[model samples]
Target: MNRIELATLIFDRLVSEKEKLKTEFQNSDSGIGYFFLDDLLPNDIALQIHDAFPKTEQMVLKKSLREDKYVAAQMNLYNPLLEEIIYAFQDKRIVEVIGEICNIENPIPDDNLYAGGISMMGKKQFLNPHLDNSHDKDRNLWRVLNLLYYVTPNWEETNGGNLELWPNGLKNKQITIHSKFNRLAVMETHNNALHSVSPVTYNGYRRCVSNYYFSKSPLNDSDRFHVTSFRGRPENKLSDLILQLDTFLRMTLRKIFKKGIKENPHVYKKEKP
Candidate 1:
């Protein structure tokens, strides 16, 4: 189905749970704010999206101590349905309703797909806890929310690749939100929203469609410009030290170069028409 049709389905589902989502996010506001809703779309449609994921070889392998996964923002090369679903979440009707649910006003969807798109994590791959880059690609707008839709069928928390939130920091245990099939999780992004994905244990892909909403104002007055920062899991002290140093160096380079020495290629650029 087209994006408009898909968006209608999304809005209907979300609005149906508006009150529950509002309270869920508010109750968590003392730390990182988040709310998740399962079965965001018809099971058959979600399965179709899952089946449309491109092979890992067709995507960009972003491997580092910081993160290990395959992501694709250049959507034209993949199945058309992938692009459709990604932007369907961007539809104004859905975006506004989501902002209302989270008590964020006038949220704007990112059309450039800067750091927004599809990702797949297979066996042994994982993302360390990190704060997302503070702003949109141009560093003009504050990134206020992350929209993650998981489509992998029959996935389980024990199978791994679960979403971990460090509301109390890594020194304490994290709260796990299973990467369940057809689950759509909306989490607030700000200075303190440190999150990551658990390592995938099974050989199946933990596929997700991601989108971010931006706003002219910061979520917290304490929010400041910072590069994406990373830290190893709680058990890896040495790795944590190294990753902290990595973040320091990157932040220092940005302080000198403003936009850093190299550009991030993780954005979609539509063909000149």
Candidate 2:
């Protein structure tokens, strides 16, 4: 289906249960608000998106102490359906509906897709707990919400690669939201919203379409500008200390260089040809 058709399908589904989603997000635990919905689209359509994903070689491999995953933001390089579905959540109606549910005002979707797009994880790939960057690509608007849509078929909680929200910091157990097929998860992003993805154990890929909504105001009054900070899991003390130092160094650099020393190359530069 085209972008409009796909967006309409998702919008209708969310509209049908807006009140339930609004209530759930407002009352979420850990001081970080969130809500998820399964069967976000027709099963067949979601399956098509999974099938259309590009091969591993075609995507950018982001592997380090922080995380290991494959991501693609240059949408034109992949199947059109993948791009369509990625932006479907960015549709104005869908964005407004999600904003209303989360009680956010005047939230704007990022066209540059700053750190937002398609991501896939294979066996043993994991993302350590971290807070996303606080602002848009230019460090202008505050990032207020994160939208993730999972399309990997037959994916189960046992398969791993599920989203882990560390609402109470890394010392406590996380709230795991399985990256189940046809599921859409929305989470509020702020100073305290620490989250990560469990390592994938199954032999197959767990795919997701991601987007972020920005606003002129911070989610919390105390929110401050910071880079994407990483941390070790609850049991890894040494690693956690090391990551803390790493964040300190990066934060220092940003203070010296408002935009950092180098440009982040993860944005989508739509091809003009």
TM-score, cand. 1 vs. native: 0.99
Top of the candidates by TM-score: 1
Q: Please give the lDDT score for candidate 2.
A: 0.93
**Candidate 1 regions with alpha-carbon error over 4 angstroms:** none
**Worst window of 10 by summed lDDT in candidate 2:** 23-32
Candidate 2 lDDT tens digits, 131-191: 9999998998999999999999889899999999988887788899999999999999999
Q: After TM-score superposition, what is the CA distance of residue 8 in candidate 2 from its true location, in Å?
A: 0.7
Using all chains and alpha carbons, the TM-scores for the candidates as numbered come to 0.99, 0.98
Clashes of 2: 0
lDDT of model 1 at position 162: 90
lDDT of 1 by residue, 1-273 (tens): 889999999999999999999999999988999999999999999999999999999999999999999999999999999999999999999999999998998999999999999999999999999999999988899999999999999998898999999999999989999999999999999999999999999988999999999999999999999899999999999999999999999998999988778788999999998
lDDT assessment of candidate 1: 0.95
The number of the candidate with the highest lDDT is: 1
